[model samples]
Target: MNIFLVPYTRWRHLAMALWCGGFGLMAWWLVLALTVVGGPKWAPEWDGPILLGTIAAFVSGGSILGEDNLRRTPILKRLLRGVIAVVIAVANTLIWYWLLQLVIPKLLPDAWSADAADASLVSLRYRVGDFLAGGLATGIACAFVRKFDHVVSHVAGGISSALAAGAAWYLLGSNFQGLTDLYLSGAALGLVWGFLFGLITWPIPDSLYTGWIRVLSAVRFGRRIPVDAPDGGPKERFVGHFPRGLDLFLPADQGVAEMHVSVAVDGRGRYAARGLSLAPTRVKRFLERVDIRYDPRRPAPLETALSSGDRILLGEGEHQAELEFIMLPKEEM
Candidate 1:
């Protein structure tokens, strides 16, 4: 019923909801009580709701989704996803809360005037609307999670979070009345939640891997390729013209395709690569040209088991692209 239901909400959230919600609620009330009892009046009482809400949102929002998809994901990649999820969730919650504040008063003016009518009480109608709006907006935010390496996915998350918040705010009529107040409160909540989640989830960059590609050209460029692959998994990849996709690139003059060759793991977990090049891909060594037997019927693609120091030249003519596989031991790596 809460925003928790938005992202493929299944039985997965029930226990988490109970556990996190209970601690979060208690944590929130404690902060409020302590602040009001002895702390300075300058301290905001809403801090309780923000902290409590952040726990429910953070753990439930990004953390839960990440758990669902953690299979085969590298640690660093997982950290990035969690950070993105937390930020988006927090943005959605704050936006929904602020907007509900403005809208409730407008839709049911009678309720507002009567509550405002009492002069001594805040309207319960607004509270109900705020709760509903928060849940709905949270759901909307959770739907945007995507693959972390994707540039567009991150951009979409940020844009969607901002827009979802705005839409919720507009619905609540937060724009006209107390917009400044809502912005200030929302900004504070976002920063606080963002900082806390960052520390708890992704304290370090634990998923990145580095490797140097020895390019075979006149001035051989040692292009650095950072590969993120699970251990014992096939080093699946493609190599071609830009040399970028090859896990190593080649010179443009060779007329290499975007994916000139394919290297994939076999059923036995051994790697095999064959030239997918439309142009001649036979090479003697690092960059030397070799006249390999050509079978015009199938382009004579040679699929062979690969290992450390396997050198193959791709392409024919004056200048052939060179490819060298350098396997570093885990300790050296």
Candidate 2:
């Protein structure tokens, strides 16, 4: 669904940000508290970025695999997927941060050398470095965690995260002198980044052009099946009772056929539902509100275009499958 148009979505967006932000604040506080005990000599400078990147990785990764829509997936599979996403996100983030540390100094040598430039100039350069590192790391990490393989989705995610990092650095740059200051800065940056991430990603076109099919019948009520393909190619999800190749698996009862209908999303993000069997497949179009039935017994099978909120009835009895086509607002996918 286009979540932004729903009344509850705003609150959901805020709740997501607050949850991530709270974790960010807690992480920052714990890291700062650790500094008071006096760690290894080289640890102080690296701790904040490391913790920030780690928490941001969790936030980004969690948003994908932990989505409400994916709840129907097996618990073990979901946990495994979540762990994999974490590993990739954290590893990618750390690698990018390390690269930035190595490259930024070389690119802005004057920023690192106190004797070569004014202290303010050096501070400004370091801030710039922070901005670039934070932005690029988070952006690239998000791309790694997302499911779909779309250039627009990747670029949008990267740019949104980069913007979040830049804004965070800009807002909280001046207060890094002491542990308390560092904690405050880190917490604020995390909070700001979470909100900005949500703001940019929640309503953008990259988030909205995809959708899923939800089973509303008694047999498989509340089952959500994704309609889009990862590679942006047309992938038909077969609906049937045979089980092995079907996307929307249904029990073999009443009038359901083996290969009932096929649903797919084209490259341009349009949805099409095609009848595959001689079963009574019907569609109640969203715009017209008219009931249209597809007769697979015809010489040429026909496919009907679907819009958000379109309803499809696979049969006419108690065993019939009621499917609702819902357009999704883009997030991680």
Best candidate per TM-score, number?
2
Which 10-residue window in model 2 sums to the lowest lDDT?
Answer: 115-124
lDDT of 2 by residue, 1-333 (tens): 124443323344554445445544554565555655755344445653566566556555544443433234566776676566566656666676666666656665574544322323424335454445554555455455455445365446544654565455545656434323444556666566655554444333333446788888788789887888877777778888887967888887845788887788777877788877767888886355433345636775677888777888887767677888876644425
List per-candidate RMSD values in Å.
16.6, 9.6
Q: Give the TM-score of candidate 2.
A: 0.49
Q: Give candidate 2's error at residue 259 in angstroms.
A: 30
What is the Cα-based lDDT of residue 306 in candidate 1?
53
Alpha-carbon deviation at 227 in model 2, angstroms: 16
Tens digits of lDDT, candidate 1, 56-75: 36533543344443233566
Give me the overall lDDT of model 1: 0.45
